[model samples]
Target: MTYPSYRNYVREPVIKVAGTGPARSGTEVWAELDRAGRSRSDRPLIVVDCYPGVDLSDLRKVAERHLPDYQVIDVEDAAALPVAEIDAKIADNLTDDRVFGVLGRQTVDDFYDPDALRQVRDQVAGRTTPVVLVGWGALLVGADGGQPAGTGDAVVVLADMPRWEIQQRQRRGAPNWRCDNGAEDNLRKIKRGYFVEWRAADRHKKHRLFDAMDYLLDTTRLAEEAVLITRDSFQAGLTAAAAGPFRLVPFFDPGVWGGNWMSEVIGLPPSDTNYAWCFDGVPEEESLLLDVAGTIVEIPAIDLVLQRPVELLGERTYARFGAEFPIRFDFLDTMDGGNLSLQVHPLTDYIQETFGIPYTQDESYYLLDAEPDAKVYLGVRDDVEPADMMAALRRAEAGAEPFDAEKYINVFDVAKHDHVLIPAGTVHCSGRNSMVLEISATPYIFTFKMWDWGRLGLDGRPRPVHLDHAERNIQWDRRTDWVTQNLVDQVQRTGAGDGWVEERTGLHELEFIEVRRTWFTGPVEHDTAGTVLVLNLVEGAEAVIESPTGAFEPYLVHYAETFIVPASVGRFTVRPSEAAVGQELATLKAYVRGTERAPVGRPVHDTKEPGLS
Candidate 1:
C-alpha cells in the first residue's frame, strides 16, 4: 500500500573530514567566541535578560572558575535599584569606567503601572545596553498564554518547545512549527531567534509528522511504522492519561530502531534530548505503549549552526571534531503482567561475531513512570555452579521448569528521578508495569535473551527467543550476586563550579562536558583540552565570553553552545554584565580527558559475509 507523502522530509547531508579541510579543534572554536566578546568591550551596554531554566548559571560558574573579577548578586535584594531593576543590579557591580554589559530580567506588559517598564527601557536605551533579550516563548507569550512580550533592543528566544502560534500563522496549511523551514528568517528577523524550538516532532501534529514519515519511507525505500496513534487520539489520551499520578510525555521516537514499545522515552525537546523523565508501571496488566522507533532524526555531522542563534552563525563553532550527533528513541509501558527473559548485551567481540553490528550496550535507566509494585531485573540472583547452570538452561529449553525465574534474575524496585548507568556486558531488563527512561549508545538493540519462560505474544504467537546467542555471550562467570545491592552510590549534584563531575563507565569516563546549574558574575574561564565542550542549560541566565583577547556577545539559556577547544588554544576567560547576581542557571559538562583510549575492534558476526572485516 502507498503511504502518505511529506513535502518537508529532507535527509540531512553527511559530514566529511579531510586533511586541512572543514574539521577544526576545540581551542579554535573557543577562541572564536572569545574574540567576539573581546571585540565588543568598547561598546555601550548590552542588557541581557537572564531568565530561569536557562544556562546562565554555567556561564557564571565558568567565569568564576577562570576569571573572578566580575561580581554576581540577587536581584530581589539589590541596593538603590535602578528604574530598570536588571540594569541597576548589574550597574551596582561596576567600578570601572568601561562600557557596561547587563544580564538580568526584562518585565514589560500592560499589567504593570503605565510607563513603568517604559521608564526602565528608556534609561538603558542608547546606552551601553545593546539589549539581547533571552527566554523561552518570549515571542509567543501573549498568543500562547506565556508571559507578555518583554522589550529588548534585540529579542532572542531560548525555548525548549516550538512556537506553535507563529508556525501556524506563518506556514500556511502547516500542521505545527514550520518556522524551521525558513530557519534563517527565524534567526535573522527582528522577532526571530526569540523562540528555541524543542523536539519539532512533539509539538508538530502526529499526522504531519506521520506524513513526513511516509514521505521519508517512500523516498528512502526504508521500512518503518506508521504514526503510532493519530494526533487527535494521542492528544486526547495525553489529557486523560496526564492527569494521574504518572504521565508519559513524548521525548523521543523509538521506532527508528527495532523497539516498538520497549525503548527509551525522549524527554524535554530534541535539543535537550539527554534530559531524563519517567514512565510508570502498569497495574496487574494495564499498558501504556507508544511506537517510536520509526521517527529518528539522524544527521551525519553536528555543527554549531544546528543549535546556535542566527546572529552567531558565521562566528560560532559547533565542536572540536566539527560534528555533534543525537539519537532518537521511543518507549512503551505495561502496567502489569510483566513477563520477560533475563537478557544480557554482548561485548564488542561478540557483537562482531554474532550480530554483524558494530555497537556496545551503553545505556542508562531513568524512571519515568512507576507504580508502588514496580521493580526491575538487574544482574543475577545467587551463585550457581557452571554445570548446574548449564543443566538448568537445558531443562528450561526442553520445557522443564528446572528453576524459578526470579531465582536467576535480580529484581529491584524503582522510582522517579533515579538514574542507573548500564554498561556493556551487563545483564538487565525492566519489570512489568514500570516505565523507564532508557539512555544508551547510538546503535540499535542487541539482546541475547538468556532465559525466557516460554511466553506467548499478544497475537498468541510465541515471542522470538534467543537462548544459543545468550549462552555464548552471557558473562556468567562475572555475574553480580544481587540487583538492588549494586545500587550503593547515589547521583549527587556538584556544588557550583566550572568543570564537570565525571562519571567513570565502560572502559572510559563519560561526563556531560559543560556547566551544570549555577551562575557567574565576572570573567568566565575554561580549559577544554581539544574535546567538545557542551553547555547544556538546565536553568536560565545570560553570559559574555571574555578572554585576555576581548569579549564575545551574550547568549540566552535553554540553548546548548558548543565551542571546540583545540590543543593549541591555552587558557581564557568569560565576563558577565553588572546585573549578574541572583540569576538561576544549570548545565551538564562532558569531555573526553586524561590518557586517551581507543575502542576495541571486533569482527562482524551478524553480517552475511565473514571475511570482509
Candidate 2:
C-alpha cells in the first residue's frame, strides 16, 4: 500500500459553488431575481439553458408573468436557422433599446458550436443590461469551449438535478426535440446524449463554470434551496471541517437482476421493475453537498480531491492514487429479485494495459441483509474443468442447453454480516433475495460478465457477455479450496473495552482494503492514521461522529448511511445517539492498509479493563 513519495500531480485552483435543492418554482425564480437586485427596468435578459431532457416551458412562463415588459424568446423557435445564423440574430438583437430583455432557451447540443457561443458572449459583454444565460452546457463547455473567462460577470446558476429525476422526466414525455418524434427515438437520443456525449465531455476536463459560479440552486428536492459560494466554504470541504457531514445525492438504476429492496427500505416509489444499484459513494459520478450559511450547495465530488488532495485523501493516498478516490461503496440489491450476472474483473496490470486505468476493481461483497435461501456464486468448483465451463457457457449463449452454473461455480449459503471477497479475476454473483454492499476499488464499469441467466435486460435485449475477456483473466487456481481458505474472512477479536468490542474481518493479499466490525454500547475512539476511512452504520439506528479536537461539528449518520473520516481529522469518536445508547450498536469500518499493525483504536494491553484479559 506504500508508494514512492512524488508530488508530480497538481491541479490548478478553481473555485465554484454548486448547489442542489427542489426544482425551482416560478415564485422562487422571482425571489432569486429580486435578491440579485434585478427589477423590471433592469433590462435583464434571462437565458434559461437546460439539459436535453429538461422542459423549461414552465420556467419561461413564470419569467414572463413576473417581467411582463421583457420580451420572451424561445431558442427552439429558431431551430430551423443554422447555428451561425442564430448567433447572428442574437448579436444583432443584443443592442436593441426597445427590448427589455431576451430569454434564450436551448440544450447542450447548441453549445457545441464554439464560434456561435463566442459571438453570443461578445454580444453580452458590450450590453449594459443584465443577461442571465442558462444552459447545462454553459458550465461544461463554457464560452469558447475551453475556459469560462468570458462568463465571469453573468449571474450563473446551475440547476442541479439528479440523474434519476432526468430519467423520470424523460419517461414522462418531457418536451424535448427527440420526444416529439417517438419513444424509441427519444430513448436512443437520450442514451447517446447523456451517456456517450456528456460523459466524454466531463471525463478529464474541469468545468470552468464551477469555479466561476456565483450561486448554485438545488432542484433535486421538494423545496428549492440556493447557496452562495465562497472560497472559505470550498476550503472547509476539502478538510472535512465543513459546516456538516456531506452526502452525495444517491441515484438508482434498474438492471436485469434489479430488486425492490431499495424502494421498500428507502421509501422510493416502486419502479416499473426493481432497482438494482445505488451510486452512493462513487465520486466520479457523485456530487458533494456543501452547506453555505443555511443553504446546501452541491458540487461534483471530484473537485474536492482535485483542489485539496492532501486534505481529502491524505498525503499518502493522494500520492499513490492522485485525484482518484481509490475506494468505492455501492449497493447491489437482489432482494425479491433475480441473481446478478456471473462476472470477473480484470487484474491491475491487465486493466492498465487495456483500459488505460491506473488500477483495477477488486471488490468484496458484504451482505447487509439476506433471506434464508440467499447464496453467492463464487470461485469455481474444485473438480470442474475449465474447458467444460467454457463449453457450457457457449452452449447457453447459443440457446441450446442452459448453463449448469452451480456445477462449476461454488454456491455458498450466505447470511447477514457475511463478507465474501471477490478480487479481480474471480467469478462471482450475488444471489436472489439479498442486499449486498459492494466495497471495492473505484474503477467501475470494467466488469467482464462471463454468463447471465437466460433473461433479457430491462430494455428487452440480451446483456452483453465478455467470455473472451473473462477467460483470460479468470484465475483458475482460485478454485474451491483456495477460495475457502483466503476469500472468506477469518474473524478475530482484535480489541475490547468497556461496553465495546472490535473484530478484524477482512484484509487479504488480493486487495489493499482492510475491514473491521465494532459492536458497542457506548462510544468508541478511532484514528485515521493519515488514511481516509469509509464507515457504515450497518446495525445501529443512528450515531454521531465528532472530532475530539473540536475542529469540525458533530456529524450525524443514520442507519445504512455511509460517511468518510478524512485523514486530516486524525482522531474521532463514534457514539450512538442518546436514545440508542442503551442498545448495542454495530458499525463496519474499511480503510486502505500501508503497514502491519493491529486494528485502529485497539486498546493497549495495559489499558485493558481488569477482567478483559
> How badly does each model clash, as a count of residue pairs?
95, 16
lDDT of 2 by residue, 112-228 (tens): 555655555555444464444544454432332234532533344444444445556656555333225335433443443333333433332233434554444444433222233
Q: What is the C-alpha lDDT of each candidate?
A: 0.32, 0.63
Top candidate on lDDT is 2
Backbone clashes in model 1: 95
Error at 19, model 2, angstroms: 16
Task: Write candidate 1's Cα lDDT for 404-474 as tens digits.
Answer: 65666666777643445455556676666555545444333355665555664332444445656566665
After superposing all C-alphas onto the true structure, candidate 2 shows an RMSD in angstroms of 10.6
Q: Pick the candidate with the highest TM-score.
A: 2
